[model samples]
Target: MERKNHIILSILAILLAFSFQESRAESRDSLFFEWYTTTNMEPWKSTMEQMAAERTPDNYNQLFEVVLAWYGYIGYCLGNDKEEEAEQYLETGWKFLDELIEMNPTNAAPHALKSGFYGFEMALARYKALILGPRSVSTLKTAASIDSTNIHYLVEKGNQMYYMPSMLGGDKEIALHHYKHAVELMISDSRYHQRHWFYLNTLVTLGYSYQSTEHIKEARKTYQKIQRIAPNFKWFNEEVWPKFVEKYGTF
Candidate 1:
């Protein structure tokens, strides 16, 4: 009878542990989506810091989450014209990312992320572009060579092409092609389309590119697709859509 009771107690303990793990996973997912849709950085940043502090050797994904959250926070600061804050976050983010890269040099994602960070830094100081530009291009090329289909690498390449001056080989047509290829890659992976914030942002970039090129119909269709997928995206619903309507007369 004592042995039977012990076995039952062990089962209950196991069940409780499983339940706790499941709850934590759900909470993390919810927090990620909330941050993605609303750009509300504080809550997500707190959660990521907590997760990172608790990370074990087996918790690689948690570490990646922390890095990705930092990336998002940097973007948020830059978008709001907080250049100093953005640079601060960028430095901290690079500290973590550089460690990860050293640990796993062949992983393409970190390389892609580092490449993007260099580009962001260049944007903040165009004078530094002469030095940082080659670094950005080289890192991205390394990432692409390692994993040609990596969505992040593709997006960075597209962004470079989109923003570079025509004199420096920036072609809107080629940029569109890269963006389209990235979208197609994401579409083929349901997990990316459903949950990845970067995938959605890539779509937004593609839409704006279309608008810039005076492809109104395509731009409106892209925006409409974003609305259908994530109506809570404030930038699209509040800013882009209104400006688009004002300029192109409501699609």
Candidate 2:
């Protein structure tokens, strides 16, 4: 009888422990979702760190990927000129992602993120032509090998083709092809698959490509599309419109 009672107690203890663990897991998952949705990256970083402390290396790879996604979000903040906070987040997030990639070389997401990282870094850099040329193409080609269907990859490749110097093999027609392909992929979604910012970027890139190739009417139409979507996005006024007018508007 005593032996049977001991067995019952052990089973109960195991069940209780499992229940506690499940509750903790749910709490962490909820916190992660909340931080992600609200763009509360600092708190999200802390939560990921705590989770990393208890997780094994294999699981930590995925956790680190989530952290890297925040890097992209924080990059958006940087676009808004939130430089100080963005720098801090970018530094930490880049380190975490680098480590994760070093540990797991086969993962497709890190390769994709690297393509984005190099692309953005060069796009915003001072000497963009000299610096961002080869690295961006190489990383993006790797990402393409891993996930060809990814719309961002297609768009980025298209952007490079449209804007890169002749020696770098920039082709305006190829760029338009990729942009159209991206649009096709997103067309079936209930919400435009290219969200507001992405759509804005696409229009700007397309307009510049067309303008570069001396297609003035096409450039005007694309810029008009952006105006319709966001009458006040800063890029529209300062970057796109000015360039469009300088190149194609009635002079």
Candidate 3:
């Protein structure tokens, strides 16, 4: 009877531990979602700091979330022209990404993220583009080859093609192809399109690509779709939409 009781207690203990972990995970997700909706960096920064401080092997996935959040924060800072703040986040983000890559060499996402960081660095220091540019492309290629279906890899590749000069083989048509493929892949998976910032950003990029190629009607329609899907996205609502209207008038 004592042996049976001990086994039951062990099972109960395991269940309780799992329940606690699940609760914590939910809390983290809630915090991240709040930050996402508000674009409030303080909450995200604090949450990431707490996660990093409490990190263990059991919470490696949470660490990845922190890294991805940091990447977004870096971009936010850069977009706001806060280069110093962006550089700070870039440094910390690189450390996390490097450790993650070391921990899982087979994971393509980290490689894609590192490639993006290099690209950001080049943007900050255009003089270094000659050196950092090739490295960025190489890392991205490695990531795509590792996981061709990864949405991040496809979006990054599309971004590279969209921004690169035409003389250097950047083709807006090819970029549109990549962006469309990425959208297709994301929409095919319900989990990917629902409240996913990356997917939304890809759509924005696709719209911009259309504008770059002088497809004003397509760009207007694309932006309109994004506004319908994510009306609260600040950049889309405040900046991109207003600029588009100013340039071409509302559709």
TM-score of each: 0.85, 0.55, 0.84
Which lDDT tens digits does candidate 3 get at residues 100-125? 88888787878888888998898789
Ranking by lDDT, best first? 1, 3, 2
In model 2, what are the clashing residue pairs, if there are any?
A: none
- List model 2 lDDT by residue over 142-190, tens digit each: 8688777666677777867876776768788888878767766756643
Q: After superposition, how far is residue 45 of candidate 1 from its true place, in Å?
A: 2.3
Which one wins by lDDT: 2 or 3? 3
Q: How many clashes does the backbone of model 2 have?
A: 0
The candidate that wins on lDDT is: 1
Tell me which of candidates 1 and 2 scores higher on lDDT: 1
| Superposed model 3: Cα runs more than 4 Å off | 1-37
**Stronger candidate by TM-score (1 vs 3):** 1
Q: lDDT by residue for model 1 over 1-251, one digit each (tens)?
A: 99999999999999998788767765666667767789787887677677667876645555666787788778878888889988887888888888777767787888988988997798689899999988988998999889977787788888888888899888887888788898988898744654567678788889998888888899999988888878898777789889998988865
Pick the winner on lDDT between candidates 1 and 3.
1
